[model samples]
Target: MGKATGFLEYERQGGVLVQEKQRIKNYNEFHEYLSEEEQQIQASRCMNCGVPFCQFGMEIMGMASGCPLHNLIPEWNDLIYKGNWELAYNRLKKTNSFPEFTSRVCPALCEAACTCGLNGDSVSVRENEHAIIEKAYKEGFAKVNIPNIKTGKKIAIIGSGPAGLAAADQLNQRGHSVTVFERDDRPGGLLMYGIPNMKLEKDIIYRKIDIMKEEGVEFKLSQNIGKDKKASEILKEFDSVILACGAKNPRDIKAAGRDAKGIYFAVDFLTSSTKALLKVRQKDKKTDNLAKADGFIDSKGKKVIVIGGGDTGNDCVATCIRHGAKSVTQLEMMPKAPEKRAQDNPWPQWPKVCKTDYGQEEAKAVFGSDPRVYQTTVKEFIKNEKGELKAVKCVNLEFSKDEKTGKNLMKEVAGSEKILDCDLLLIAAGFLGSEEYVAKAFGVELDEKTNVSTQKGRYATNVKKVFTAGDMHRGQSLVVWAILEGRECARQVDEYLMGYTNLSPQ
Candidate 1:
């Protein structure tokens, strides 16, 4: 759809990244976008291949190969390459509801599966998407679109994360009155608090939320559906209830002296950090001066140890560095991945290679080395006389394959215990599943994995007019997957309410 030989003629160039040395000084979006002309050149590199796997949206070897939302990559790339910004945004929005969020935070599965990436650099699809969405907002193409017809049906979405927001957007557009309930003060659940502000600025979330409010979608923030408002009341009021609260019940570290005062869950830490920043910004209209905010977990001049080596751990490392930490260390139970893709992990399959995310990059730039310590786990949390964290006892781990099961098993290595000074410990061990209270409150059954259960390949619950989607239904996953499930769930709900739906069949 782009230039026939553009892939051969042009090289891949991405958005300008602010130097870590300077960007780490504050919490802000650090990537500077390219000009429209430059983005058009990048878009022109789209091969328009016979099999455009960039939008395949399927599983390969149990790993996601492309955009789960099935974005029309080629058509939008062609439109952008022709300098048709409005049409590019139109095509882009046909599939994705929140391009701004995904363009910034998504791992870019599209590029991973691009045909050009098989031989060389892939098209900068994510950057192109970012450019298109930002331009749409600038040119007023993304203004509020209030529904003209009212179907008189009401929907209650019991969360404000990507999934809940997607469903609310879709259902509201379909002429159903939608009210989104969020326990947090802000509307974007994980996106608003769980994710660090530097990765996704709060203003960006607010921008879209304001548009939704103008478009007739109601947001009841600081309202916990089960506690603040009863489930029975919501059921009686709304025609359909969608539980998209997400899997946020954190898996805690079960180590000796686990009750240390300075240890906290990763989500709590991130939420507090973002809240502190926002409080400071709101008071002074500035991003800095966070020291004045209350309830902030101060890591200044403290030795910090983070448990788990995923994105949350990396975010903790960067947040600690920004807090003026004395030193930082990250513990991971699993062994480090290979620097490059393994033979078993080929192209079009999600690569199992190591990635240095933005947070890790900032940590290295400040600390002179990567903070991750693979094949290691904390054995005990050493506490002081006041029951505050003072140090951590760690042990090395080793893995061996079992001949019968053909599965790898982990064991603690003998005589490898070490004690490191740690004033603060953050557990980023991930989530178990959706919190049981919400499910129990609504009489929703849970699967073995603790996710809200449903019939195979369906969003309907045992209760009539009650559906579920996103992490609550499928366990923890990416934002793109959440949006896809939300859209699908909305279609199901529309059909149930009106006995038919015109929404996309995604």
Candidate 2:
């Protein structure tokens, strides 16, 4: 470490954020990075613990703790502390294929179980990581690394999200002739659309896609493998196929009047907004909030009601605010989590706590209050004469444990019903599983949860020479887990193709 006592000497500094009012006006990322020297100081705060729990990927109490990619946290932190930006990037890339994307979108699981965070604030590992990767991109160290030898083995990957992209990067670098099929007009499926641009700008995704193209990965856009092209045809062409389509079957509300107009899935709304922005930016190069809302449903001047209190719900709140919504509200069926970790949640386990994310912050800033209401849910939708959403009837929820079964049962509180005016109702209640179309097209079996069936603890599917990774197999999860699944799945695919492979597991 650059300074042995740096953790004690310096206070933890996270990425600075743009003022909420100002940031809500634009769809750009709000967090600003610290300077080089300040970032070095933040990196120096890494304790370099003998255990280095930050890099320890482990499942505790049904939730993953620490970095799933098992990044070389201590090594990279030391490099950053010493001002060796290139070396830090090198160490980071040893495990992760795309740091730039993860730096922006990931929830910083590494920081939660950090040794420094046991009592005090955690080392700013996430921001330090951003600084490292951004420096790499700016200083020209992140150039295209074309594979020296061509394996001449052809591989087809379906989907172009983080998992698919990571697998393509690894396999292509190993000299495999990899072709990625994306159903969207562009690559980076959810990264391009599901996630709001303010969280992860579209250009950052295109930049990485550009690099992948230069390194010999062919990206076929607007091709739905099972629909536009036949899965059987791809199976005949490629030696092996990997499916990385994310769990995108959104969980929709079935309350009365659900079919009313002015309601949409969170992903659909986000996708439409991004598509409009892309269309406008490409045509006129304007960054202002002006875009064609022809087919896409908009929330401008509409009372918006969002169901679900997760990150996606928060994103909806922020997006609605930016769209000039008259008012906004988010509904959570469950009781609010504790502000601090409970006694049962000890160190090294994922903490269940209340943390206001950027979207919630933006919502609070714009509407003069937080949009989230704990222990509440939409009971039914109210509609107008034209069958459009006019408002929603909500009811307060009370959870009680069963005396004998020990199961938490939800009970609707009597006389606790209220109706809120709403026109745009966006369901942000997470996903069920991968859409059945692609999995069914490949003749692969699905698990009870409707995810692609894979061998226990493995990525191989029921069909021979076919594999599934990411949310498509693992259910809805964070981006970092998708990257890990992709890397490990690629290694297994390489082994299957080359008899014995040289690809490193993440």
Among all candidates shown, the one with the greatest TM-score:
1
lDDT of 2: 0.90
Backbone clash total, candidate 2:
0
Model 2 alpha-carbon drift over 4 Å, by segment: 291-293, 403-405
How well is each residue in 43-70 modelled by candidate 2, as lDDT tens digits?
9988889897888888888878889999
Off by over 4 Å in 1: none
- Model 2 weakest 10-residue run by lDDT: 285-294
Q: What is each predicted model's overall lDDT from 0 to 1?
A: 0.92, 0.90
* Cα error of candidate 2 at position 460, Å: 1.0
